[model samples]
Target chain A: GAGVSQTPSNKVTEKGKYVELRCDPISGHTALYWYRQSLGQGPEFLIYFQGTGAADDSGLPNDRFFAVRPEGSVSTLKIQRTERGDSAVYLCASSPLPGTDTQYFGPGTRLTVL
Target chain B: QQQVKQSPQSLIVQKGGIPIINCAYENTAFDYFPWYQQFPGKGPALLIAIRPDVSEKKEGRFTISFNKSAKQFSLHIMDSQPGDSATYFCAASNYGQNFVFGPGTRLSVLP
Candidate 1:
């Protein structure tokens, strides 16, 4: 009955630092996704996981950005050498089957790179 | 480039009035069109959705009108309430792929 949840509702870090944002998808969800939302813009796709393996990582901006969902349940988005441009709300969503199914989103983690 | 485009970045409507938000996409491969509502400090929640085959779909006061030929879709909220004030985002996706979302529309339903 629980919805998706993310950790560290707000995180502030210095430039060049690394930060990890975690996501806990709803129970029984098989697909997970990560996105970034900048001010006055729509959420941009980051990465996707079908199970324990990432099905799509093309949305990831660069090699500094990486994500993992080892158990196919919980996921973590890791950012290396954070830049001010990376400052935005990191969103996580999950679906029951994937594809056309409705995606449930979490509150998101606002990461600020100062 | 933005694959999906939404019109009227902001809108204000009185209670019980209809507020329509329109969206258009350039990709013909897209099949799923859904609208999401979000409030401050909250993640987006699914409001209504429609497929390309269907011309329209309605759920409660929310309706989605899809035009397969024009590659356009619109969301109409009938008899809107003050509580309806929030940001609305229109998104499109192909089968089992990540969504391409529009910039979003901010709706203000006055009481």
Candidate 2:
């Protein structure tokens, strides 16, 4: 009965550098989602995966942001040419299935672009 | 334009008192509403959720009151404790779609 987990609790990188954030959803979960939370603001949707395939990715900010969940269990969020504006807490969540209302969330990774 | 709007950027209440937070959404397509609680340096946790079909739902001291006609909903925490101090976010989304979160309200419960 493990909850969702994320890697690199905190990350600091220089502008223009690349970064990758990983997420491990709860066992048996079929749906995954990614979000970004800036200081003093609510989380902003980034991408979502229904299985091995991404079901909804319209929330991705730009072409530089991408995610992959090849196995349908674990996911990784990749960012290219990181900018200061991208600094925020990257959150991952999972639900038992797509369309489920309640989602379990991970601690999240704080990315800082200096 | 923000799809979901929450009132009172912050609130302070004494222990055992009730604190109410309200949210309104512009999109009629939304059918699910959920409330999440988060502490500093941590991700949000689901506190409670409600569907448009029901007018109100209660779990323990947490209650969600929904108004389908006005497109508004509110969360009322009865007998709040100091440990309840944190940020609360109200979110709305259609089934199987991405969620839209409000700016959030910071609640402070004094012992």
**Which clashing pairs does model 2 show?**
none
Q: Score residue B63 of candidate 2 by CA lDDT.
A: 100
Error of 2 at A91 (Å): 0.1
Top candidate (DockQ): 2
CA lDDT, candidate 2, residue B17: 98
Candidate 1 segments whose C-alpha is farther than 4 A from its true place: none
Task: Output the lDDT of residue B90, model 2.
Answer: 97
Chain B structural similarity as TM-score, candidate 1? 0.97
lDDT of candidate 1 over B23-85, digit per residue (tens): 999888887999999999999999999989999999999999999998899999999999999
List model 2 lDDT by residue over A11-111, tens digit each.
99999999999999999999999999999999999988999999999999999999999989999999999999999999999999877878899999999
Q: Locate the minimum summed-lDDT window of 10 residues in model 1 chain B.
A: B92-101
> TM-scores across all candidates?
0.98, 0.98
